[model samples]
Target: MTGRERHGTGARLRRMLAYAVLILFALVFLYPFVIQTATAFKTEPDAAAHPLSPIPDPVTTEAFAQVFGGTGFPLWVVNSLAVTLLITAGRVFLDSLAGYALARLPFRGRGAITAMVLAVMAVPGVVLLIPKFLVLNQLGLYDTYTALVLPLIVDAAGVFIMRQFFLSVPPSLEEAARMDGAGVFRTYWSVILPMARPALITLTILSFQSSWNEFPHTVVAVQDPALYTLPRGIANLVAGSLGAGTQYPLKLAAALLATIPVAIIFIVFQRYFVRGAAEGASKE
Candidate 1:
């Protein structure tokens, strides 16, 4: 074969290899969900008999019915929604504001503040469990919605994400706003915020996912059934609520329900994720 023919053949082979690898990885990542889904639809007997199988022998909705009917699942859903919404909103707003200040606002101790935030991020969250609990106790907020929502209102990582994004943003835009007599908050609210769609989306997704799946913080913050979020509730279910029984179908159904919101969020914002990434690259 000529050199051009040889090059074309090699490129096609490489493309095929890459596609094969991606498909393999997709299966590996998706297999669990497939199994979970099939198991959720499975009879308790079928689920127990074929634990790893991704096909249900006898599809049933009993597990789902039980999740809503037998447990405090609906209450758990409400608690999760309330806590997740509060935390997500708080983090997005507080973190973005802090990031803008760090990036644009000139002030003494800014470097120290940035370092402290970075330090907070570096420290393991587990180490703060006791301190957080103690503080909650002192504030008389334990086992309350305040306890669940207050502590997570600010996140260091979200701040860092926003900071980096703000730094990448063209300062000329802010400068123009200033020249037009816009105050700091006004500039941020009108000009900067509109331009930060990608970073905001990233922060939103991260905050939602983290807060939705939040277990550790909730465990430390509250034990009241009325305040129990999905993760905490599910943990109890696995620990003993089934009375030494392993109900794989019920467990999978609950998990599947818990996972759906985040999945939908990702699907809806997927294009924005890509667009945001591309914009970030160009901005940087």
Candidate 2:
């Protein structure tokens, strides 16, 4: 073959190899979910019999009924929904406001404020558990919904993401608004925020997912079973009273329910998710 033909053949081989690797990785990541979903429909005995199977034998809804009817699953679902919605809305608004200020407003000590936000982002979440609990207790927010929802309302990472997104957007848009007698907040709300739909959706999805799946903070924030979120309730299911038997089907069903909202958001806003990821990488 000519040199050009030989190079083309080599490139084709590399591309095939890359596809093979990607397919293998996808299976590795996705097989467990397939198994979990299938096992949720299986009878307890059937699940045990075929741990890796993606097709359940004699599929049943006994586990789901037990979850929805017999357990605290419904309450947990309600609590999760409430907290997730509040936190998502709060974080989106606050993060965007703070991000806009950090990105656009040239006020005194802006650099220091940015630096503090960055520093806060760098703090490991686990490290704040004890301190957060203490503060919640002191503020009398312990065991309250306020405790669960308020502490997470303004995430540093969300602020940083919005700040980065705002930074990437041209200042010219805001400048034109300012020229039209719009103030900073008005410019941001009217002119800039509309353009930040992609970033906002990404943040909303992420915040919802994170808050929905949250476990540690929930443990620290509340002690009442009545206030238990899905993750906390599921942990109780796996490790507490309902944990007595090898209730794999029930456990998987609960997990599947918990995962549904995030899965829906991911599917619906996948493009924004990809763009946000790219934006994040570019910012870094």
Candidate 3:
């Protein structure tokens, strides 16, 4: 073969190999989800007998029916929705403002505050559980929705993400806004924030995912069964809330249903999420 033809043939083979590897990884990642889905529709006997099977021999909706009818899953959904929405909104707004200040605003203690944020990020969150519980208890906020939502309103990682993004923006934009008689907040709201859509979307996705699947914080925040979120409820279900024998189908159904909202949101905003993450990475 000619040199060019040989090179082209090698490139095609490499491309084919790359695709084969990616497809293999995709299947590996998706296999568990496939099992969860099929098991959700399987009879208890089928699920237990064929735990890893991707096909349900005799399909059923009994597990789904029981998830809603025989458990606190509905209340868990409501609580999770309320808490996750509030936390996501709060983080987006608060993190953006804090990031802008750290990036652009010249204020006393700004450097120190940024350092503190970094330090907090380095600290393990599990270590804060006791302090969180004590403060919530001391303030009489424990076991309430307020306890669940308030402490998580702001996160160091979100602030850091927003800061990195804001730093990447050209200062000339803010300068132009200021020359047009815009104050700091006005400049931020009208100019900076609009340009920060990518980072905002990234933060939104992370915040939503984190708060939606949160279990540790919930353990310290609330103990009331009436106030349990999906993760806590799922944990309870796994620990045998259904009582008697193992209800694999019911447990998998609850988990499957719980995973849907985050999956749908991620799929819908996937493009924006990717753009945001790319921008954030390129910034610093």
Candidate 4:
């Protein structure tokens, strides 16, 4: 074969190999979800018998019925939705604002503030629960909705993501807006924000997913069962509520439903997420 033909063949082989690796990873991540979905509609006996089965032998919605009809799952769903929405909205706005400030505003101690944020991110989140609890209690915000939603509003990672994203944006655009007599706030709101769709979507997805799946903070923030989010309620179901037997079906049903919101968000904003990651990488 000619050298050109040889190069073409190698490129094809590399492409195929890359596709194979991607497919392998897809299966690795997706298999558990597939099994869980099947188990959600399965009878308890059938689920127990075929724990790893992706196909339910006797398809049933009994698990779902038990989820909504018997347990506190509906209340948990409401709480999850409320918390996720508030946190997502708050984080999107506040984190982006902080990011914009850090990126564009020339303030005193900017480097120190940025360093602190990065340091906070580097520290494991689990270590901060005690301090969070003490501060909330001392402030009398403990066990309140404020406690539930307040601390989660300004995530360092989201701020970092937004900062990196904003840094990647061309400064010429903002300067042009300024030349048109726009002030800083006007420029950010009218010009910069509209151009930050990809990063916004990415942050929205992440904030939604994180708040929805937040069990640890829920544990420390509020002790009332009334305040339990889906993750917290589901943990109770698996650990304390489902008594006397291993009701795999009900647990799996709750998990399945819990995963649906994040799945939908991913499906809708996947491209934006990809673009955001690319921008973040390029910025780094």
Candidate 5:
């Protein structure tokens, strides 16, 4: 072959090799999820015998039935939904407000407050568990839904995300609103928030996913069985709720069910996540 033709052929071979490597990695990462799903449909003996197999022999759904009927799975779902929704809404609204103030508003102690937020983000969440429990106890908020939902309503990471995003927004937009007789809240509500849809969507997805999968915080927040969220309840299920046998099918089924909502939300809003992140990274 001619030089250019030889180069093109070599490039095609390299491209094919790269694709092969990527496909291999994708399968490796997805293999566990495949096991989880297939095992959920398998009988206990079948699951234990062919744990790595993606196809269940003599497929069954007794596990799903048990998940719905035998345990507190339904109650866990209800509690998770309520708490996650409230936390997502609260984080979006409150975090954005704090971010906007840090980014745009010129108040005293602004720099100090911004530094404090960043510092809070650097602190490990587990380190604060004892203090969180103590505060909850002192406020008479322990073991209540209020205890579950209140502390998580605002988060340092969420505030940092919104602040960075708001900083990317042009100051001229807010100036124009002010010139048109809009007050601070009016400008934020009517002009700024509409333009912030991409960032808001990103924040909403993160907040929902974080709250839904939360386990450590729930340990301190509530003790009532009725107050348990999916993560906490699933942990209990695995610890001893099934009585004696391994019950792999039932466990996997419950865990699989818990993942559905987050997966759906990510699939739906994935396009906006990249856009918002890119916009936030750029400065005017």
Candidate 6:
């Protein structure tokens, strides 16, 4: 064969190999979700019998009924929504404020504040579980919504993301606003913030997802069932009555329901998610 023909054949082979690898990985990652979704509609016995099946023999919504009616799932949903909304709002606002200040403002101890934030970001979350509980208990905020939402109001990662985004944006925008007699806060609120929609949306989605799926923190923060978030409530359900029978369908349904909001947000804001990922990679 000619050298050009040989090179073309090799390129085609490599493309085929790459596609095969990608398909394999896609199945590896997405198969579990498909199984979970399918099993959710199956009867308890059918789920056990056909663990790998993607089609249930007799599909039903009884599990969903039980989740919403019989259990405290509705209450858990309410609690999760309330807490997630509060935390998302708080984190978005406070983290952006802090991020902008750290990025643009000139003040004493700015470097020290930046260093401390970086250090705090490096600390493993699990390590704070016990200490957080202790502080909450000491401050008499234990088992309250305040306990759940307050500690997470300003995440270091969110602050870092906003700071980096602000840094990347041209300083001239803020300078123009300042020259037009805009105060610092006015410049941030009316000028810079309008331009920060992409980063802000990314942070909002991330904060919502993180707070919604928060389990370990909820476990450490509250003991009352009334205060339980969806993840914590579902965990308790699985550990307690739901475990007595092979109620894989019910458990899976609950999990699927809990995952829907985050999934919707992910799909809707997929572009922002991609941008955030690219920015993060560039930072690294």
Instruction: State the displacement of the C-alpha of residue 101, model 1, in Å, after optimal TM-score superposition.
Output: 0.1
Candidate number that wins on lDDT, 1 or 6: 1
Clashes of each: 0, 0, 0, 0, 0, 0
- What lDDT is reached at residue 74 by model 2? 86
Displacement of residue 35 (Cα, Å) in model 5 is 0.4
> Model 1, 1-284: lDDT tens per residue?
99999999999999999999999999999998899999999997888788998878877999999999998999999999999999999999999999999988999999999999989999999999999999999999999999999999999988887887888878899899999999999999999988888889988988999999999999889988889999999988877686766888898899999999999998999887677656555644
Q: How many clashes show up in model 3? A: 0
Ordered list by lDDT, greatest first: 3, 5, 2, 4, 1, 6
RMSD of each: 1.8, 1.4, 1.3, 1.9, 1.6, 1.4
**Which 10-residue window of candidate 6 scores lowest in summed lDDT?**
275-284
Off by over 4 Å in 1: 277-284
Candidate 5 regions exceeding 4 Å error are 1-3
Tens digits of per-residue lDDT, candidate 3, 1-284, equal: 99999999999999999999999999999999999899999998888888899999898999999999999999999999999999999999999999999999999999999999999999999999999999999999999999999999999999999999999889899889888999999999989999999899999999999999999999999999999999999999999976787798999999999999999999999999999888888877
Return whichever of 1 and 2 wins on lDDT: 2
lDDT of each: 0.91, 0.92, 0.95, 0.91, 0.93, 0.90
**Candidate 4 stretches greater than 4 Å from native:** 1-14
Candidate 6 clashing pairs, residues 3+ apart or interchain: none
Clashing pairs in 4: none
Q: Lowest lDDT 10-mer window, candidate 2?
A: 237-246
Candidate 5 per-residue C-alpha lDDT over 164-187 given as tens digits, one digit per residue, 9 for 90 to 100: 888877999999999999999998
Model 1 gets an lDDT of 0.91
Write the residue-wise lDDT of candidate 6 on 1-284 in tens digits: 99999999999999999999999999999999999999889888899999999998898888888888878888998999999999999998999999999989999999999899999989999999999999999999999999989988889989988888887778899889999999999999999888778789889999999999999999889999899999999898788665477678888899999999999999999998788757755754
Off by over 4 Å in 2: none
TM-score of each: 0.94, 0.96, 0.96, 0.93, 0.95, 0.96
